[model samples]
Target: MSSQSSKQMALVAFMQAGSTSVYAGSWRHPAADLRFLEAGYYADLGRLLELGCFDLMFFDDRLAMPGIYGDSVAEAVRTGARPIKLDLSSVLGVLAGATSRIGLGATYSTTYYAPFHVARTFGTLDHLSRGRAAWNVVTSVNDSEAQNFGADIHLGPEERYDRADDFLQAVTGLWDSWEDDAFILDREGGVFADPSKVHELRYSGTHFNVRGPLTVPRTPQGRPVVMQAGSSGRGRDFAARWAELIFTGDPGLEVARAHYADQKKRIAELGRDPQSVKMCPMAYVVVGESEAQAQEREGVFLNDLVDPMASLTLLSELMNYDFSAHGLDDVVTDELIASTTGIRGLVQNLRSHIGGTVRIRDLAGHRATLLQGPRFVGTPKQVADQMEEWFTSDACDGFTLAATHFPGAFDDVVRMVVPELQRRGLFRKEYTGNTLRDHLGLTRPEPSKPSERGDDV
Candidate 1:
């Protein structure tokens, strides 16, 4: 929807080149369009997002394939079988080169990597992209990811988030290691960097100790924009404190509003501007010329589901539980669910947003009423209308576009839907800012004030 100022809502496309090759029966669709590890796949997708005037494209990643379903990797792989695993950062560079203006974001696990390394890697990417870079901060969730990192077990949820909080503090600290005026070319004295301007992070926390400074300086945005995907209570608090953009999966409008309200309340309670943290909900669009055509397309996509069982397995892995033990009719009430880990928070959010009578086991299998992810399906105008309602109603700050089928579907969105949004003046006709933060309307955050920092004992 366009604001009175004519600022249309923002769109971010989520894609992994291999997302089509396997995982969730994606390869089975006649229109799934799978390709080997190739740069052209990303290049083509990037061009589509650029054409659509999307604010950015983020690569959602996991360290390893799904290993939780029935405690075997066979189903996930046999379905050709999902995330089969690939390096997204190398591919992001190719996508960055393919398109201009559209921001690029990648998920990197803080639990596994040192904060200083995150500073250097994303800082370098920000430079490489000419300031169009975003980092989706995540603590690796599943056990498969842990084993891949050479650890026999995954850290407990609270412990992982504790480490994550410290990690981000240190990474951002490193980004600000060199002040804006730190580099001074004093030809007379033959000195380049002014020693007085550079300061050490000296980050010492319960989970990590990142010493002093980093090799890389800050990028155009001062730092890569911080993005996060967590709707749990603890997750929401963390987002309020650190995230500039938050992603969520609220299946219904009611859920969206509840989350929107909760986050805004928290943002206020934390004493941050309500506008500072945008709560963007995840949405997958399946567009057609007409409503009937869209429904038909949805049917075809469901029929094309390469492996029915694998879709459920993916959902199971997401919930961090075994959804297969029950049937589609099996029900979970408010009190029946429990978790030793803090994952119950996610479950509560899902139930509250999902609404109505829900069959616990239905979460598995091929097509669901809510589908595999949060969804919006209809003609372009119909979809745009829904987007407008959400944006204006404050249901979300924006939406993330996930391709139902690639290239063709995404192309339809750019060609058909984008023009409609433009006519309404809900979106930008041209690039407003050079950096991703500018595109997202975020002020570059300065270093912590002297008092915001804690003094040593």
Candidate 2:
């Protein structure tokens, strides 16, 4: 048995289907790919992450273009601020065909989609990917997304989580509709499946009522791995009950440590093994041949490449409040914090990071990186050292890496940083298993009978 201290770190590549990753102006970088809509682009990305031995590559998404900045889409379109969006499911399918080991994850909102559709979609993905699929469950945050879904306004956090609870129940029930041995495929017997093994999920809840057996059969892993990235009180509780993997963006190491410990405690309180739930926070790394070189590159990104207006646009969308109305020198106030309907945890994190007070312009640009997570800029050894410190201190199981520029940013890590991590024995040199659960050191869940099935968490 491996000792607790000897556990390997899990790494995931935080990706998107748009022209840029998380950074708004990254697309302007000469090395960044402009043709993100092409299937070959994602295929190359998938293969690269697999080459680096990443546990998974997740595609983050939004349902609508960000128009909350000044309540207009002009700035969003002009700055190329996540304006080009693609269907994540179709992107995942492309990624699935390109890579074999690295897990393919796609973000799907629980708010807009029916439980049956979500279930069938991910279940089909899991089958197509040969047990290497993951679902990044998200509660749609922006009012623009709600508007596209025909809602006059976005639901509050509590109500969203409440509906999400029902959503999870119905989806997992549908996944469990078919047992592992249900398909006999007997040609002589003239039967493709055993009727006795197939079960119906007659689920009725406040938000959804899904009934009957799912169209898809049982997947290779029984069910796709469930990942959640909410950080509020309700979000954490929901994650504790349901998520096998948790994503977060705490700005400081101390805060991340606290969040990690609290989540593990909550998991234990929920009668689940704390070791089973992994906490991976987002990180941006800029690596170079030397520390000074890395610093210079980082300066180019933050100073030259980043468009302050575009950055603020994303921040406004994330906070669900208009920041364009405020003067550049205006202080981020308590009233502003209280008025946001976006994400309470994110607002609180921003407040904590700012401490006393922050100017509108400064907060807008800097918080773009801070709000996403920590940023580490240095040589490969220095970056690896910070990662080791966080991993060893229990701040996180690993990191979900975000790119400052397309292939260049990722290439730097894969070439410079990954070797150092491998030298320290902190990361995998090669994948030992084909399934995503295996890559994460999680045991495959056995199929449960209909009567024996309880909560999916």
Candidate 3:
């Protein structure tokens, strides 16, 4: 476990395989690259992040396009509001060959995919990357995603978590099918592997039932480091149980500190070491040579690029509701709150930010800007100072850096901010180990039954 004095922050890059990032205005930035459709774009990104000595970079993905607003994809596509989403598996494959040290990850939803497929895919990735693999698990939202999978409706949050519990059980069981020493490669004896060491996972659960050992052998870091990015109460509990890294979007320093403390307490109550699970909030930074210049750049260049329709479209997509169905001034209601099947944490954040009641216009504005996360606008030293304050205050373990533009946003952070962080000794100066687990200070788990694994913390 990392003591407070010795605890260095673990940084990750929050990413998407699209033209823009979480910010709707990213693609329009004069410095933003528009070649997301090609493999080279992501390769360049991977290399840049690795050069900065970032711990991991995971692509956040959604199964369906943003078609909830006005029940059409036209506005989303026309404004370039996250309309394009390439297959993450293929993109990660490209990165696997491009970079060596930085951890490569991609989001895969448990709601749509089968456990065996997810287990096999990530297990193979872990091997191919030579232990530099991570998987961001998500219980998908959006009925449009359900529709694409031939389902008429999306499941409620309770049902989704319950199903996810079982899904994780089956997948981890499959990952643990082979022991560490299962593959012997005995040539003279004419045997490739020891059959006695390889065991079959005859898993029978509410959501899945798989019988047999996986095709792949035990992965180098046991399994790719498990990552989760949910912040609702149930979501927090789920993360405490499974995730080694948890990504969040707290709006300010106080909120972040509260969240960090709460999550740590929850982990401790579950008999897990609080330090074992790193809680990293999303940070949207605008770096420049001077603080005044950075603020000017954000005010003049970045903030103005958000189209109104893009804001409404993204809001509708995330809430799984139609903004066009109501007027901009319409007050948010209990019914409206209950109806959302999307990110419950985001809706809650919206409510808290509004205080009494939220309006459609308020939601639109927040969605247009960075959603419920602190945006650092300053020079390298100023940005680093803010980050150091948050780190020392127990507000976060680190940050999931969100981009305002593609290469430019990343380039600025790597070249300007990272060195300051390193000088303070709040972040790593160099990678000490190759695997994602090593990067995060987690132990390589031994093969064990699903019921017995998390018990040891």
TM-score of each: 0.91, 0.96, 0.96
Error in Å for residue 99 of model 2: 0.6
lDDT of 2 by residue, 1-457 (tens): 1112467999999998988888888888878887797999989988888889999999898899998988998888998888888998899999888999999998999999999999999999999999998999999888999999999888888899999999998888888888888878899989998887787777878988777688998898888999998898889999999999999988778889989999999999999998988899998999889999998888788777777788788888887888888888998777877788887686676567657776777667665443458888899989998888899998999999989978888888899999888888889999999899999988887766667543322
lDDT of 1 by residue, 1-457 (tens): 4434344577888766475522354455566556646677778888878877788888887777777778777776776556555676788788778887889998888888888778888888888898888999988777767787898767877788888888887888778777777788989999988766676667788877776666876688888999988667778888888888888777677778888999889888989998877677877777888999988877766665545567666665665556667666787765545542424555666666556866665444323333434666798888888888888887888887666666666787788777777777787777878888888888887865422333321
Ranking by TM-score: 2, 3, 1
- lDDT order of candidates, top first: 3, 2, 1
Model 1 residue pairs with clashes: 2-426, 8-426, 8-427, 23-82, 76-81, 312-364, 312-365
Candidate 1: residue 28 Cα off by (Å): 2.7
TM-score of 3: 0.96
Better of 1 and 2 by TM-score: 2
Q: How close to the true structure is residue 102 of candidate 1, measured as C-alpha lDDT? A: 88
Query: What's model 1's lDDT at 283?
Result: 74
1 against 3, candidate with superior lDDT? 3
What's the C-alpha lDDT at position 106 in model 1?
88
